[model samples]
Target: KEIKDIVPFSLLTLHNEKYNKLQQSGMSQGKMKALLHNQAIGHLLKKIAPNVPEAILIDQFAKEEVYYSYLNKESVVQTENVYFSTKAEGIHLAVAAASILARYAFIKHFDNLSKAAGFKITKGAGAKVDEAAARLIHEKGLECLPAFVKLHFANTEKAKRLVASKYRK
Candidate 1:
């Protein structure tokens, strides 16, 4: 609904299951970011004709080493067409549109997770998120976290400490 005015030529959705699997496999955040970006580009490239010129502008992920590592692993034929810029959303309409679409997808997935958890799961690694995660741990135990969190975030430790403190009392 948020993208009613935007005509989307290509869309890619990343599921939490896939994210959890990648994180559990010991993939660093930077590399995961790069892999996901590469997958999106690869998906988009498959839709267009081979002769058509395509320029991909992504907002810089702050991990140039990982970005370049995964970018080079993408289809070599289109590697030359990929480009990255700091704050690319401000410079390119396509990037901005993609950001909006990505946000919409995130919100939709968050809503689904919340529904499954029977509670409102807040976003970010703030106090509220930590508290909610602690509550999740309290109700469902730590084993359920990978289904609900990125595991590697500092918030995971915070939430664990919170749950532990509650148990000690």
Candidate 2:
């Protein structure tokens, strides 16, 4: 049987609702949620069935920084700045699982924002966020805007003008 079918829809819905609320609260909150989710998922996976071998986990954590560097498509800055050193040295199965869970949590949060605000919010930390903010202004009223968005963005000023002009006419 499929996991979705087995798990009650109401439980899933509640989980998603809580997740979204936590995500929209603040950046720090979101980060904390992601970390917690990652740790929890990692523990759960270990509890269920351990198929992942020790060797693979060690290889993954050993190259974690390298993998993070690859993700930086725009600049080589992260490659220079970030470093990963595991004390365990053998195989970081829990850490690897946590990484996957954290990523999944982030994506789910992003998707939830897109759905709630009625547009596809792009992925990433900067440009995507700006695009999402602009889209939000276009779709939703200025009063409904999130504090995270810069009120000084050109698009935000333009949106204000458009709304004002519309009301004047």
Candidate 3:
């Protein structure tokens, strides 16, 4: 219900294939993921800019401190109107609604990806995640791991090393 009222919202999903190609460009996983998110926000802003009456208000992500200028900063859509207050969701209805929409989209894609990988793909970069990746590599194949996860993730290296060590067994 939090998101249901927020109409005219835009969303973008990044699949593993896209991330694999991005990973080849030698970008760090965190930066690459941030770029994707920044681009998505830019897209949403662009979509609503025209409909906005004078100014478009945006809720800042709690983690977003520095503005990512690599994402078409020179574009006509100005950031002057964007609000970057911490915990803006708690203070603004728009922010709370956007957070809800973002979470819903994330969960939906996670489930879809899990189904495609044929195993429950856990979220985050914990020991369990590394174990899951190693098991996935062993059960599937060395090459198939990319089809299931963001290869740019640093965990991929640990998982790969684990897979290699297991091969000697």
* Stretches > 4 Å off in candidate 1: 2-6, 62-66, 71-77, 167-169
User: What is residue 41's positional error in candidate 3, in angstroms?
Assistant: 5.6
- Tell how far residue 133 is off in model 2, in angstroms: 0.7
- RMSD in angstroms, candidate 1? 2.7
Candidate 1 per-residue C-alpha lDDT over 67-169 given as tens digits, one digit per residue, 9 for 90 to 100:
7776565543345666778989999888888888878878988998898778999997799999999989998988988888877789999999999997556
lDDT of 2 by residue, 6-37 (tens): 32211111243344455556423324333443
Show where candidate 2 strays beyond 4 Å: 1-91, 147-169
Model 2 per-residue lDDT at 158 = 57
Q: Cα deviation of 36 in candidate 2 (Å)?
A: 5.7
Q: Quantify all predictions' global Cα lDDT against the true fold.
A: 0.76, 0.45, 0.68
- Scored by lDDT, the top model is 1
Model 3: per-residue Cα lDDT over 50-110, one tens digit each: 6653444445433334444444343434455555666777886766777788789888888
